[model samples]
Target: MSVERDILAKNDREANANRREFSRLGIFALNLVSSPGSGKTTLLVETIGRLGGELPITVIEGDQQTSNDAERIRATGAKAVQVNTGKGCHLDAHMVGHALERLAPAADSVVMIENVGNLVCPSAFDLGEAHKVVVLSVTEGEDKPLKYPDMFAAADLMILNKCDLLPHLAFDAALVEANARRVNPAIEILRLSATTGEGMDAWLAWIRGGAVEARRRRAAAAPRAQGCACAEAAAKA
Candidate 1:
């Protein structure tokens, strides 16, 4: 237990440093967490397609073992890096930190990481992301938040994917949204079907929202940093 704690502590420190590095480079990172078959990849592809021309985007896909997701993203005409964590249940900040160095982003670029499909463990580690988007498919049942509270609780945004299949799957979109809000009052939820593109406008809008906000925040912050630097220089004089 002590050894495990030590490892986690080290990883946490590394994650914080990774956050600072990403911020300095002006990369808005987003970590996607979900269960297997929860449409993480599909959503990622759609996101890249939607935002491809709007902003420079790259992907880092985490899996226990598979180059499949990376290959899929590559097919979509976006740069992709695959992180295969053998036997690991989740991705930590350390893995993300190492991957970031390998795929350094230009200022104001986006790094979208699709975490290995599991709701629990990934929530424990922050990958220096602008936000953690949790994807829940209609096929996964409406009671998922009840089953996996931690992931739902940690997410900044909730994406209810596969809404095109809502009629077939009997997935209650209402209940899912309600329970998610119950668990995370602060979470913003969107319903979309990445497969048929139904309700995609909302998802695309949210992605654009982030990019726009990041650009705005960067624009807002630049003068403040510059002002501080000038003040410090004047003090030195």
Candidate 2:
């Protein structure tokens, strides 16, 4: 228990540093979490294709092996850094901070961190993202949220991907939403198919809204930051 607590404490400190750095740079970061085969990469590819022109976007791909996802992200001409976790099941805050240095995302831009495909470990590790967006495909059982309650409870929003497949599957979207709500009543839900482009506008709009707010926050903090710097300079004199 002590070891686990120590591990998380270190991660939290790193995460806070990352959050401050992101705010200072006016970067809106989103941590995308989900089980394997949740279509997270596909959604991200489509998202970048449509919204990258309007917003400066960079990607940090987290996986156990292979830079395949990062390659797909770069194919869209957006900057991407691949963090291969090797034996690790998740991307820790320290790893993401290093990746951010390499990504060098611009001010008022979005940094999409595609976490290693796992619901359990990623939920506990904070990557200093503005929000955690959990992706669940309709092909998965609705009881998923109930089984993986920690992930749903931790997420700010739950995205139901592969909605276009509803016609062919026995999956119950309503049940999944209900289960997710049971875990997190305040969690926002969005259903979309990355392949068919259905419901993407709403998702894109959400990203735009978040980016705007992130920019607003950075602008609001600038005066205080400058004042602190000036105070330090004066003290040195």
* CA-lDDT, candidates in order: 0.86, 0.95
| Runs of candidate 1 exceeding 4 Å displacement | 1-8, 224-237
Q: Judged by TM-score, which candidate is best?
A: 2
lDDT of 1 by residue, 1-237 (tens): 344456467777887897777676667788999999989998889878887887788999999997999999999998888999999988888888888877776778788999999988999887778889999988887889988999999999999888888778766789999899889989999888888888888877777777667767777878899999999999999
- Score candidate 1 by TM-score against the native: 0.89
Model 1 has a clash total of 0
* Number of colliding residue pairs in each model: 0, 0
lDDT of 1: 0.86
Candidate 2 residue lDDT tens string, 95-159: 99999899888999999999999989999999899999999999999999999999999999999
